[model samples]
Target chain A: MRNLLAAILFACAAWPAQAQLSIEITGAGGQRIAIAVAPLAGEGALLDGANASISAIVRADLERSGLFRGLEVPRLVPQLTEASSVNYAEWRSRLADTLVLGSVAARPDGRFEVRFRLYDVVRQVALGGVAYTLTREQVRATAHRIADYVYEKLTGEKGVFSTRIAYVVKRGERFELQVADADGANEQAMLVSAEPIISPAWSPDGRRLAYVSFQNKKPIVYVQDIEVPKQQIVANFKGSNSAPAWSPDGRRLALVLTRDGNSQIYLINPDGSNLQRLTRSSGIDTEPFFSPDGQWLFFTSDRGGSPQIYRMPAAGGDAQRVTFEGSYNVSPRVSPDGKNLAFIMRDGSRFQAALLDLNTRQVQVLTDSDLDESPSFAPNGRQILLATIIAGRGVLTSVSADGRVKQRLTVSAADVREPAWGPLNK
Target chain B: MRALWIVLIASALAACATTQTPDTQPPAGVEDRAPGATRPAPGTQSVPSTPVTGVDLSAGRPASDAGNPLRDPASILSQRSVYYDFDKYDIGDEFKPVIEAHAKYLREHGVVKMLIQGNTDERGSREYNIALGQRRAEGVKRMLLLLGAREEQVEAVSLGEEKPKETGHDEEAWARNRRSDMLYPGEY
Candidate 1:
């Protein structure tokens, strides 16, 4: 025992830092997915002494998917010993779909190991056993990776918990652009300014963003390199300047400008050159979006009165009107499939994100909740991220295209609006 | 483009100066000039700028008698709006006869009001289309006034893409929506 102590001390003195990465995999297949994260129990237990508990972090990761309802118990550590052996039948009766067991231990050198095991309750099988070892400083990152693995195993879906979501939060006259973990954890403001920002679109590579800014006292679209947090105005057109929709290739953007005495459509490169006009109309033409295939561009106009949707060639051609059933229609976003389209339908003053099935010409209302706008599709096209009002506060929301999961992201209380989900990891 | 803007402004200002008198103006420079004759044709006198009276702006006619407020109100059943190819705003030959008959009504009816609601097929932004429809309606309004309709009796507004006479996602619906609707002041 004395030798073990000295060896640990000597190792600590000779090494940079003791480290490990712990991962918790959730169980799948009919058995409720299990996760085992317990609060640090012993004295001087490594993590900020249990503030952001490992168990709570893991639980939030599982719960936020609108999947994996968690196990509600007084404590998870009670089941650590065999003395509390697997009370299988009792657990089954308790409706525990899965069980997570884990413990955190610290070394004398300050190195720590968060070991966890996932068990399938119905099958009486262990799904995975792993340990995340890390120096005292890196516990949070370890917890996130564990969540990612468990999410991947159970849902066959890539875990976005380890990813980040950027949003524009409007506060009176000022607006804050914030970045937070996909689960709404660790939110921090990137830019705060007293200006209007509309049409925040993520580039295909995800390192840059393009948005319309009123910083010039006029509407000008800017391409912001997120890594450097640098903002450069790419378009400053005469008359109205708004609605910057990025091409799927991420090389160009479609926007509206009234430089010719009428609001017309123009495509500009991200570097602020090669400006090309796509529509020459005597009416108001705005809100241009390129099809995912990059063949056609869709937009909204009032040439026929009120507001309706129209399509034109991205390279410029005859403009064709699409929406006729409604008195007012605007802000069309084409789905990635080059099939269905999602747009904002205005019935009187109420605006909702409505979906159009190209095959059947059927319209589906994807959101019935309060004043929602700017619905954007996830990379998978199965879900949409948008901004909606919650408890009198503007918050980010996600609804599947089928309208199944209506989840409100738990970001800061600063009126978060205009959510644009980035593309999957390249 | 800057020169174009100047030309447009000058023409608009010029239009403001040439207000015809509401008299027995035979369309002022009322020319049965053969088609394809450009304005100011080589020493040809432009209409002497006469005032027009007793003309229907919607039906484009003079009053049947003195002080007649109502236009002849000819049945416009066969008088249909001519559709243009895509972006062309000029009326085709098929529509000349319609405009001629409509112009005759205005020359006879002393006082009449007409609203030409311009339109476009749904394919672009609602705001942009509204502007396009305005141009189309304004273009039609200009043609009617040039043919002798009173300026005060004609008003043009663009409906954009809101109303369509046909229902389909094809050429037929598009062709129908791309023309102006002649609306009587009190009629839907």
Candidate 2:
């Protein structure tokens, strides 16, 4: 019996070697579908070889989802780019349940056309095919869109590849608010200042960011257009004006302002008018976040003498405490499904990312880092992005919603923090 | 006595004008001498100029000031920072005397203005820390106001976790960073 147990352990260790990308999915709670993406065929130069770049990005997106395992397929005879030319027997032997093949061509009008086909190997049928006509600049976005399409078709749920992440990067005395792709690529600084920048909250439409900037030598909330680079101070109250969280409909923002004696949650229009107070706690009340339905607003408050997560009506009412397991829980970010709350919970002097199931009232710590904060959930509710300290430098990290598939994103020679994953691009 | 006051005012204005222009040299015997330095007999007793009344005008005063109580290490006003526990903005009993002393000073000198900067340790959400730090600064501001400091005399702002007194990540560093610092205008 001991030898049998040893053999079982050996098999567990050896099973991961069978896959090309050994994606360790810990808490997915389902069988991972095996998918293989063949290299795309192209004729001429397509933005530094678009065929390879596009397929790699698609494979990476699927693998990072923690729901799919990319299988290794050896170069087969007559590399197939079309669905009708695929040999089901060959891919079935390679053990890939789903296969993706594509080809790219540069058009005469400085545009590129990328066509892809998805095949079900075991069923010997074509799942689908799509052709995207995009400019050179839109190639990466088109790749993410294709990945989203494939993911939705396979998982029956929308993918988050088309989403963007906004974060604050501090290098020396300069601070930059940067927006990057979901996979931490194509970073573009939206705002740069000598003073500190914090709390980058993406608008519901993914076109604007509301963040706290110290450019005026005081913490003030500014809603900046991500594309046009224009900004207006949404909360420049006398005292501290910070912690901007947008409503789901993108019309309003719930923020924490200390204009009145102490810090309290207040709702304001995106145009910086029609101010309405939301919470009336005498203690420190801040970090206001709206539920996906826009009916409830979850926030962090210390009114009970200790910081904890609380929720109240979006219009305003009494706040009911939600978290009780830990003495310290703050920065509650509700998931897109409105069923889970991602927050930072103090654990023996170390703050870590945690998720609370709204239905079961069970809290699960999602990270083991010594200092983790600003837990923002992906639009699809499958991942949580947070800021953590690694080797004394602040870096951005993401963990799957179920506490699986962790990834660290670091900017060289800079400290990155306060990462807010934006809504899915429409 | 009236002539002495007029001479003091004239000398103060001359000192201000001299300091404002970079190329202007100090008048004769006042050349680069420290404040309160005694000069040799030249028929005129060089009265040192004080920019702000009742405030120390000297630079790099010793931490253990034995002459001036305002700069003395033992003076309550010298203790300019009030520290707090992790994520708690409540004023501790130990720091009440220190704050009361500053409040008394501010009230006695009605023209004195101070900026209260609240800071938090490097932990938790950055924006939330801003609120936490602001509460700490406001806590001190409330106490100062209750003790008779004018509301306009004190401007409270939160640096959040951006500025740290100590850069380490341990409890000691965090304890030192979670503090509210009292600053006179132009001090920062």
Q: Which candidate number would show the highest TM-score if scored against the true structure?
A: 2
The local distance difference test score of model 1 is: 0.62
Q: What TM-scores do the predictions have?
A: 0.57, 0.83
Give each model's whole-structure lDDT: 0.62, 0.78
Candidate No. with top DockQ:
2
Worst 10 residues of 2 chain A by lDDT: A14-23
lDDT of 2 by residue, A1-426 (tens): 446444543443232221111123334425778999886776234556534477777888888787888876555545557544877787888899999988888888888889998888878888898999987677678889989989998888899999989888777555778888887767777876657788899888899999989878898999999888877989898988888899988999999888887789999998999999888878888889999999999988888988889999999888999999778888899999999999999877779999899999988999888899888898988889888899999888889887867777777777888889999888
Q: Going through the candidates in order, what is the number of backbone clashes in each?
A: 77, 0
Model 2 residue A348 CA deviation in Å: 2.1
Q: Which 10 residues in a row give candidate 1 chain B its minimum summed lDDT?
A: B38-47
DockQ of candidate 1 against the true complex: 0.05
Q: Which TM-score does chain B of candidate 1 obtain?
A: 0.57
